[model samples]
Structure formats: C-alpha cells, structure tokens
Target: MTQHLANFKARPVACVTGATRGIGRDIALHLAAQGYDIAFGFRDEIHASNLQEELVALGAKVFCQPLNLFDAKSINSFFDSLNTAQFGLDLLVNNAGITKDNLLAMMSQEELEQVIHVNLIAPILCAQAALKIMLPQKQGCIINMSSISATKPNPGQTNYAASKAGIEGFTRALAVEVARKNIRVNCIAPGIIETDMVSDLLKGNEQQAKSKLLSKRLGKPRDISALVAYLASQQAEFISGEVFNVNGGMLLR
Candidate 1:
C-alpha cells in the first residue's frame, strides 16, 4: 500500500488555459514544480512557445496549444486534442479571461459579448469536457479564476465584473452536480495582481491604488499561485464550491 501511494504521488496531469502569461502562467509553473505534467492553451503562438519552453526546462511534460476562447469551435478542438491516452488530466484550471473596460453607458454589445464568451462561456465548455473525462476516474479538481470585481462594482469594468460574477455562480452550481463523482470545483478571486495586463494601470496610478488596499501593496502572481496550488492539491480535498479572495484585504466579505 505504501508503494502504491508513492506511485500515485509521482506525477499528475494538469491543464491550464491562458497560461502564456500573468496569473495563469504562474499557476502553470507552480503546478509543474509540484509534480504535475503541464498542458496549457493560449491564443498567441509566440507567447505560448515561450511558456512551453519554460515549463519543459522545469522537467515537466508540457504541451501548448493555440486556442481562441472566443471561438467555440476552437475551444472544443483544443480539448479534443488533449483527449489522448497519455494526456489524461487530473486537474483543470479555467484561467483564460479578458476584460473590455468601459462604463455600462458606453459599453457596446460586441464588448459585452466578447468578455462573456471568453470569461464565462469558455470556462463552462472546458469544464463540461473535463467532467466527461474525470467522471470515469471518479476524481479530478477544477479551479475557476474569478475576480473581486465580480462582487465589488467598479465603474469601468461592468462587462468584466458581470462575467466574473457569472463564473462564481457557475462554480457553486457545478460543484454540487459533480461532487458525487469526486470532482471538486472552486474559484479564486484575485484583486489587483501585478501582471502585464494591468501594468499600465499600476504605473499610472500606483500611489492611488496602493492607498486603497489595506495591505498597502498590490498582490504578486506568486500570491495567487500559492492559493491555486493548495486548492489543486490533496491538502484541499475537502474544499469545494468555495470562492477564495486573494485581494490584499480589498474586500471584507
């Protein structure tokens, strides 16, 4: 039994979307360090290749696929490519997301649709595909990347907030449906993480942003990655349908 347990702990397969950079990239690297083979999907070929190289250097079996979350066909095709004998995934991280920052008054239909499609719908589709594979094994972990904006309304991020809020709701509902199969689903709501996507905002209003946080500092990608690694591990097996806030005390609730 001890030998069997050791074999089980050797390596696990994990798939992370939007892993070319930012929070997703960090999560991918963190998981690899924890003995998980890495498979990530990204829209940019150049960025995806770079990330693949980094993961390979970490001694992980890494596969990077070009996937457009906005395109439903592409999303399905990407997963199909992963449904292979040697690539059975034990963990799925739905981290692919986009933000079209504009007040509701100025938001166009195209803007709202794009955000919803990528942030909410794409994750749902990916989760659905993952569930089919996980059900047979009766074990898997799914982590959805949400945001504090989902709960706290911000002026220019109406579409982003709504999409993230939708993910929160989806996480809770799906967790209940899949718990019987030993599939745990949860979300991580990150607040003001220092990433390339928000470099401009941080650079332009560093002082104002720092003052707003109780921690008096922005969150780092590693901070979020640590929480994600825990939730994906056996250490958090009893945790499900929960939303973790890593926002530097930005939201009390």
Candidate 2:
C-alpha cells in the first residue's frame, strides 16, 4: 500500500466499462487498491452502488453511472459526465462486452448486431472520447479486453470472436498512431476465466477444462487485473499495441 502511494503523488484516474461485476469489477477494485481514482459504468444501478461502496472503502474516489452499451448516445454521455466531473481520465479499460452465442446460420441479425455493438463499437467510441483528454496531457493508457476465442474460438461464438479480433486490430492501429504522443494501447486475451460469465460452461466440465490447460486451473479476474495495473504503470511505458494472453497457458498443450 505504501509502495503504491509512493508511486504517485496524485492518484491517476481510470474509467472502466462494464464494471458492475466479474472481471470488470475486479479490474476496478485492483486499480483502486493501487491508488487510482475509479470511474466505472454499469448496466445495473444496484451493482453500481455495491461496487461504489467497495471502491470508496479502498480510499478511491468513485464515480458510478448507468451505461447502456447498445446505445451510442449513452456512451457519449458517460464520457461527458466524466469530463464534466473533472476526473481527467489517465486510463481507460474497455472491458465492457457481451456474448450472443449462435452459429452463423442460426444467429439472428439483431443478436449479431447487439454483440458487435457492445463488444466492438463501444470500445472504439470510448477510446475516441478518452483521447480528447489524453492527447492534451500526452499520457494515458487504454486496455481493451479481448479473448482467446478470437484465435481459438469455440462453437457458437462467431459474433464474440469477430468482435474480439476487431479489438486486437484496433489496438494495434491505435497504438502506432498514438506512440509518438505518449499514449499507449494494448489488449488482454483471457481464456476460460472462473467468472460468472462462464459459470454454467464450467459447472460440470471443470475437470475437462483443467485438463486442456497446462496450468490445470482456470484464470481469475485478479490475474488479468494485475497485468492491467502493470500496463498502466511506467514499467510498461514502452509497451503498446500488444495483445497479452492471460489464460493459464490454455493456448498450449
């Protein structure tokens, strides 16, 4: 704790999307513990309140708001509030995403569009907003939450995989564009994390999932959060436009 305080005289601010639960919540808390003022969005007011209390307890200045990723207006409004509140975001974590599982043949247009809207389009918009603030400061970090599915997708995840793959490409392009400006962009590809997002999938197949990974264990939200903290720090100042795999070696045999 003391070390974290020593690292920053003034706490940096981070805006995280989909922070009501699961990995997003964990990322918000982890950044708070590291002495960052947290500004996060949620679809549920109840979840937002709970997370606000927790972040406040950690000595972080917390700003919680309702966000609808499906609506472009809502995305714009979120950043508007952040700017109005003078939070001056130093980090933006594009962790808000949804999965609408279905094969190409069975998938409805609405379902596919919804997934793409939330998972891919929202991040691009948020990054655009954050840059307005960051470019002036000439320092900021943006971490997009990608997935292992982008490369090794499972059945019925066409929409999810495509959105994640888009994020990787966006991360690379943006990183290069912002390199000279001192802003950084990166992506995190998590595999089979033990979050509510996949609780059902892991219920009866825990052992089966474990057997496939060299670590023989599922990844945790904390696992990804720790890496996010590092990337946001000076240690990773030279690192950008890279997609990091945090899947307990799930990609390997």
Per TM-score, the best of the predicted structures is 2
Off-target runs (Cα >4 Å) in candidate 1 are: 1-10
Please give the distance, in angstroms, between residue 39's alpha carbon in candidate 2 and its true position after superposition. 0.3
Q: Model 1 — which ten-residue stretch has the worst lDDT?
A: 1-10
All predictions: root-mean-square deviation over Cα?
Answer: 5.2, 4.3
Candidate 1 lDDT over 187-250, as tens digits, reads 9999999998788766779878778789998999999888988998889999999999989888
Write the residue-wise lDDT of candidate 2 on 1-253 in tens digits.
1101122226899989988889999999999999998887776777888888888899888766677887778888878877765557799999988888998999999989999988999899999988988887888999999999999999999999999999999999999999888999999999988898688767888999999899988888999999999999999988999999988887885
Q: How do all models score by TM-score?
A: 0.93, 0.95
Looking at candidate 2, what is the lDDT of residue 236? 92
- Clash pairs detected, candidate 1: none
